[model samples]
Target: MNEYLTSLDRPIEAVRYAGLTVKLLSTGDGTEVIHHTLQEGSRWSMQPQEGWTASESIFITSGSLKVTVDEETKVLSTGDVVSASPIKQGLVFLALEETEFIYISSQPVFQFFSEIVRKNQELAIEVALKDGYTAEHCKRIMQMSMLIGERMELSPGDMCTLNYASYLHDVGKIMIPKSILLKEGPLSEEEWEEMKRHCTYGKELLEATDSPYMRASGTIVEQHHERFDGKGYPNGLQRDEISPLAYIVSVVDAFDAMTTDRPYRKAMSVENAIEELNENAGTMFHPEVVKIFIDLIPEWSKMKQGV
Candidate 1:
């Protein structure tokens, strides 16, 4: 890796192989380091000295794992490291819950990881379209949120998370009943409660895949509905408790929704939407992000018009 760019700058992408989530970190000298996410039901196994010859090692970062090495079984938790070794019985690794670890290998699988990320993205977009979001809407939100991200000077990893979170934010709508989603009037309290489940649903859907950006974005998706003052839903996380990416997405999400036509009402003028954003600053939305977004409204409008 270049001294100028850390591994986080290596493009936020990850791949799922045989149900295991893997993020290819860096590669050189035929050796590579990758991050792995092992869900509870998922297990990883290596055949006894199977063909590929590079030695492998694992360092568990979080969650618990059951490992069977050379007929010996042990349960390992966070901060545990399994050194590189070859055993005749091969290896069996099962996650007791959603687990994260770093794996180093003397082999390269970049091309393979890259391809799975691509396919996962393609499928995510398709899933979004099926749930009633127009392609243009998703694009505008992504562009606007990224603009806010840029203004905030978020790190490369954070900016990527913001972009993807905005794109997939509404995916949870898929689980809502079409009657409720397409209703021409405001939702009743009961319906509103059900509708809000989209945030939780969105997180679940995104977490099911290996795409690094998508999985990372899931946190923002679930928190975008939350308010800075602690009145948001799914979970009442407030103040700095929310992800900054979620805050940026929340502000941009509101701006776009207000200024665009919806089944429930006609679009609010840009001035009104701007006013709404200002009115809620420091309470409903983060004041800083709202200011940054409002400051860039003209530029945002140009992007919206272009879209």
Candidate 2:
């Protein structure tokens, strides 16, 4: 094997989160060096797993960073170095501006992070297969959510959260009984209550990963059912109390659900779905999101028609 590798060499692994890219630069002798590029306004947080005690060191190579270790926070520019104490409570790194840094830590720690991303990907596939509509519905929701997110000019971090949350929002449905999920008639009141538990299940599912991105995504999963008028379930959180990403997911998910065939009903026409959304605007859905989504329907239809 070659003793040295160049930038052209393929990364051992790479992952993107919250507008940041993490690349495994090198690993050997129980240590790994990871390169991180954080887009301006991006932030990453790490909380040590129980019994974790290895320290990690970071060196900034470009741009500016705001780093918090325990109770202390510091701003660092190019060429600055900071070392985190042995794995303890919250350690946060934020890019005040676009920043590049190298982090050195035990290879096992890096491996753990890599494994979590891989597991999440695998679980997503499993969740998508639990029902026929889930895969297609999630895909459409992701696309529509991105369109609305672009229209809203969301920040990069927000877009990242929105992207992941849209796909994983219904993941908890995997746990629902197949009979209830595929029921062709109206659900019993008891079945409906059981169905509503999916949001909480989804949140718990994502929270197990202990990833900041997953945590953010979990928040959306939990609140996506909330209404603008504060009548929705799980938590009845009112307007603006819900995460903006959750609002986007909620709007897009509803649209996708209306336009897609369900076991209980055929798909609604786009015009009818739009009417339904309009009727519920500001009560069940965010008014601005509803407006933007309604405005985009024409373009979506045009594209579908190959215009």
Model 2 — TM-score against the truth? 0.60
Which ten residues in a row are the worst by lDDT in model 2? Answer: 127-136
Relative to the unseen true structure, what is the C-alpha lDDT of residue 141 in candidate 1, on a scale of 0 to 100? 75
lDDT tens digits, residues 57-164, model 1?
Answer: 789999989865544679999999886554244345668998899888776545544553454455445544333245566666776776677678665556556656
Cα TM-score per model? 0.58, 0.60
Cα lDDT tens digits for candidate 2, 8-126: 45645677543667887787776778888888755555554444466678888999987644446789899988775565554456689999998887634556456654554544555
Off-target runs (Cα >4 Å) in candidate 1 are 1-133
The models' CA-based lDDT, in order, is: 0.72, 0.72
> How far does residue 103 in candidate 2 sit from its true spot (Å)?
14
lDDT of 2 at 227: 95
